[model samples]
Structures are given as C-alpha cells and as structure tokens.
Target chain A: MKSNKTNMKYDIIFFAVALIILVFLFLAYFFMTRSNGYICEIKKDNKIYGEYKMDKDHEIDIKENGKLVNAVVIKDHEVYMKEADCPDKLCEKMGKISRVGETIVCLPNKIVITIKGDKGSDSLDSMTK
Target chain B: MGVKSTKNIGITSLFLALALVLSYIETLLPVFIPIPGLKIGLPNLAIIIVLYLYDFKTASLINVMRIFIAGFMFGSAFSIVYSLSGAFLSMIIMTIMKKTKKFSIVTVSSAGGIFHNLGQIIMAAIVMENYYIFTYFPVLFVGGIITGIVIGIIARELLPRLRKIIGFEIKGSE
Candidate 1:
C-alpha cells in the first residue's frame, strides 16, 4: 500500500511535467512560427518550382508531366491550396497561411508550399544563427 | 512449455485482431480535425494493454503485424512507413517506462502517445524534406495527450478484468 501511494505520486509528477513541457513547446512553436511573410515558395519533390508574392492576387496551376496536380492561390496577403488532385486532398483542407514557416503540404504529389519573409529578415535559419 | 507457448501465441493473436479492428474503425470515422496527420490513435489501447499484460517482445510482435496488415488494407504505402516509425518509437519508450516500475499505466501510456506523434512528425519532415511540418507538432502533441489518457484509463480499467480471465501473473506495478 505504501509503494502504491508512492507510485501514484510519481505518476502525478510525471503527468504534470509532461503537460508543462508540451504546453511550453506548443506556445513556443506558435510564437516562433507566427511572423508576417511576403514571399511564397513552392517546391515539388524537394525542388524549387516557383516563388510568388503574397501581395499579388493570382492563381497558379502546378503541373507535372503536362498534368495538373495542384493549384495554388494567393490573395489578400494569404496563400492557400485552391485545389489538389492528391488522393487525400489534405493540402486543400490546410486552410490559408500568411505567416512565415507556415506550410501546406500535398504528400502524394510531393508538393510543399511555404510562406517565407524577405531573405535574412525572418528566415528560420537565421533565427537559429 | 508447448502448451504455455501456444496459449501465449493465441492471446497475442487475439490482441492483434483487436488492434486491426480498431484501426479499421478509426479509418471509417469522419475526419473531425482538418489537420492531415492527427489521429485519436485508438489502436494504441490494444498495444498498451498488451504491453502491460505480456512482455515487450509480444507487444511489439503484435504491433508490427497489425500495422502491416492494417496499413495494406486501409492505407497507402507511405502510411506504413509513418506508422512503423511511430510505433517503433512509442514501443521503445513504453517498454522503458514499464521497466522502471515507478510510473502508473496512464503515465506510461501517455508517454507512448506523445512519442508516437513526435516520431510521425519526424518522418513527415524527412519525407517532405520540409521542416515547416514541425509547425503541426503542437496541435498533435496535445491531441496525443488527450487520446493517450483516455486509452490509458480504459486499459487501467480492463487490465484487472483481463488478468482475472487469463489467470496470468502480472509482474511489477500493480
């Protein structure tokens, strides 16, 4: 009975610690990733496909081998996947992104759209440096 | 010895079937959260229960087989890779925690849940070759915690009943 009580105490401590750390990480990640971004970088299969300005409202149809795989739209300082042919269409449901480090990924098509600020202004790499 | 081993195998197979059914049921449910990779991780209940009831080897064997069969049945090739990494990492953490014998079932299970999401996020980062995927980590982490606790509570309730029926001696951490 005594050991059981001690174990219960340990469990509560572990739970509190885990909860605090994860909540801290969640907040830290949120603030760190939240930043005004002007440039949108699109990549396919880890290769740069195009870069677009978020200030401009336009539509881009991403093509692979003469077939449309995804459509990206930029409007009102935000970007989103307007349409995607991917089986899951998760990218289309990712909503819109206007902050640096935000991304919409289409796994089946291997496409990633990331919001980035001007070079060296708010780059995550520079933040680490 | 033969009879004991057979019983072990039989029980392990039953757990595997339960895990697979849970996986299938999860797929059939509508996606409540728009986040692409976030899941309630229902099948983890079976895995956690098995880990506590049997040894690590038995739990992992059931886990791996369930992942393969369920992945092929309901998910894509990429899902297998993602789940394999997640399950492998979670099992390692759960086994370590269980070995310590200081934490409760809920703690061990929740730890397993958090690491499972982390492992999947890591795999997604590698596959997408984009670090931005880590942004989803926070939401998934919280989701893992909630689901883990729920599964843990259920397992805690079911374990004693299961032991009563199976008549196997439970070792360490009552």
Candidate 2:
C-alpha cells in the first residue's frame, strides 16, 4: 500500500509535467499555424474533387449521378459544409473552418474538406489564383 | 473450460456490452469540433475498469469485442479499421502499465489515451497515403491527454467502490 502511494505520487508528477508540455506544444501549434491565407481542398472517396481559393466566395455542390450529395460553402476566407444528404448531418454541424490543417468530414458521404496553408515558396497567389 | 473460466467469460462479455453502449452514446454527443478525429472516447472507462478488475486477457477480449460490435452498429468500414487499430494499441500499452503497478490509474489511462490517438493518426496516414496527416498529431495529442485524464479520474474514483460492490476477489494483482 505504501509503495503504491509513492508510485501514485511519482506518476502524478510525471503526468503533470507531460500535460504541461503537451499544452505548450498545442498552444505553439495553434498560434504558429494561424496564417491568414488558406486553400480549401475537397476530397470525395479519397479522391481530390476540387481546390478553391478561400478568398473567393463560392459554393461547391458535389453531385453523384446528377444527384446532389453534399454542398460546401466558402465565404470571407472560411469554409463550411453548408448542406449534406447524410442522415446525421455531422459535417454540417462542424461549423466554419478558417485555420490551416483544419478539416470537416462527412463520414457517411465520404467527403473531406480540409484547409491548407501556404508554405515554402510562400506561393499563395500561384496556387489559389 | 473450468467453471471459473466460464464465469470469467460471462463477466468479460458484460464488460464488452458496457463498452459498446458507451461508445454508441459517445457518438450521439453533439461535441463535433471542426477538427477531425477528436473524440472523448468514453468507452475507455469500461476498458480501464475491466483491466483493473480482471486480468489482461479478459480486458483485451472485451476491448476487441466492444470495438467490433460498436463498429458494426455505429461506424463505417473505415472507422472500424481506425478504431480497431487504436483500441488494440491502447489496450496493449495500458495492460503493460497496469502490470508495472508503478503508476496510478489516471496516469495509465492518460498514456493509453495518447497512444490511442497516435495509433489512429498512423492509420489515417496509411489510409490516406499522405504523411501530412501527421500535422494533426499535436492537436490530437493535447485532446487525448485532456480526455484521458478525465477518464482516469473517473476510473480511479469508481474502482474501489465497484470492487466492494461486486464482491468478487480481484482476479489478479500485485
């Protein structure tokens, strides 16, 4: 019992320190990845559907055999699933996404919408425009 | 199998059912953030409880059965693969930590949660054929720790009382 108590104490210290480091890393990533420009990349069934400029306001309607299955809307540099035919509507409820590396996924429809930030050559215009 | 083993099987199946129901309820939660793959993993409570109350093999069986049943009931084929990998990895890690008897339940659970997320991320990278999926690691790690701590605390508080109530001699321990 006494040894277990000591083990608990040491374990608490270890987990506390680890949690602090994780929080630090999370905050650093959160702040560092907050670029203003992001590209909305859409994928359906693991295949690239389209890439859109966040700067442009447009709605993408994903159709299957001339039937609309999902709709993605990008306005004022934010992307969201505006509509989906899935029963749960989880993708629609994911809210707006503006950050790089953020994604909205509709599992039922197998649609994934992710935002990619400009990196390397800082080629924001070359790709989006 | 002996009578004792038969009893163990029944109890393990009960734990499996509990875990599956907990997982199902978790999906109904309206806590869908914009980030993908962030889940509170409520079923982890049942896994931890079984690990503490029973032996490693029983707990692992419950974990596997729970994942399979929950996947068939509430998840897609892709999700089944992701969850199977994550649950298996987390179970192995937690069982080892429990064997050490050097860490508290919360610490073990937190570690389990973190590894579970790591497993899912690896599977996601493989499935998507994109190494860039690793970019979600940090956020998922933080979320895993927070949720893991919560689960660990709950398990810690409940275990002693449950052991007393169940009135079964803990099958194995130091």
* Top-scoring candidate (TM-score): 1
* Interface root-mean-square deviation (Å) of every model: 1.8, 4.4
True contacts kept of each: 0.76, 0.43
Give the alpha carbon lDDT tens digit for every residue of B46-79 in model 2: 9899889877777777777787788888877778
lDDT of 1 by residue, B60-109 (tens): 88889999999899888878888999999999999998999998888888
lDDT of 1: 0.85
Per-candidate Cα RMSD to the true structure, in Å, reads 3.7, 4.5
Please give, for residues A1-129, the per-residue lDDT of candidate 1 as tens digits: 999999999889888898898889877787767779989999999899999988899899999899998999999999999999876677888899899888888877878898988886675746544
Q: Which consecutive 10 residues in model 1 chain A have the weakest lDDT in total?
A: A120-129
Quote each prediction's TM-score. Answer: 0.90, 0.82
Q: Which candidate leads in DockQ? A: 1
State each model's CA lDDT, in order.
0.85, 0.79
**Model 1 residue B171 CA deviation in Å:** 19
